[model samples]
Target: MRYIISYVSTVNPNISNSDMTALMDYVRLNNNAIGLMGILIYSEGNFFQILEGEEQTVKMMFEKIRKDYRHHNIIKMLDKEIISSSFSESRSSFTVISDHYNQSELHQFLKKEEEHNPEHYKSISYLAQKFMKFN
Candidate 1:
């Protein structure tokens, strides 16, 4: 069965864009190796991420993420087994969203960014707004 894990966390204020880019680059690579798929967003010192894959792999990844020092105060929002990955149909198996924008700007940004996938735009924007406590 497939599994999913989603969470929100506070980013370390000291993290620079280059640092995050490197980190996400590694994450994206590792995710592909492990057959993981999902989205990760960092904005205004906050993060919202979703990871889905084999149950064992997803659980193990979350453990590693918990020990990561780049972010803290992780609040897990969703975890469960699913029939399949929700991201399976997405061309970009792993999506990343990050910027210095506020709530309004972020919403506009998501809109413009996902113009190719309205289905993703809906769910992703809703979750992002909710995680930022702006919705």
Candidate 2:
């Protein structure tokens, strides 16, 4: 079954841009190899991620993320068995909200989804919208 897990965490204050890029690169590569697909959004030292994959694989990844020192106060916002993967691309996507162009584009994309699927676009979608607005 396909599972979706959404979580938020504060980025360690000391991590630099280059470090964040490297960290995301590692995550994307690993996730791709393991059949995971999702989008990771970083904004103002906070991370909002949505991962979709097999139950055990996604759970195992969440556990590793919980122990990672690069972030703290990890709070899972959503965990549900979904009908299909929202992101089915080969590799996981990463977006740093500092880039206004990309950030706005993502926000628009989610907003469109929210309008079309109001029921499924609940708390997680709201939280993503709010996270995108963070400076």
State each model's CA lDDT, in order. 0.76, 0.74
- The true-versus-predicted C-alpha distance at residue 32 of model 1, in Å, is 1.7
Query: Cα RMSDs of all predictions?
Result: 4.3, 3.4
Candidate 1 whole-model C-alpha lDDT, 0 to 1: 0.76
Instruction: Please provide, for model 2 over 90-130, each residue's C-alpha lDDT reduced to its tens digit, 9 standing for 90 to 100.
Output: 32443333432366756755675576556656764767778
Off by over 4 Å in 1: 89-92, 100-123, 129-135
Against the correct fold, how does model 2 do in TM-score? 0.75
lDDT of 1 at 76: 98
Q: For model 1, how big is the CA root-mean-square deviation? A: 4.3
105 Cα displacement, candidate 2 (Å): 4.7
Clash pairs, model 2 backbone: none
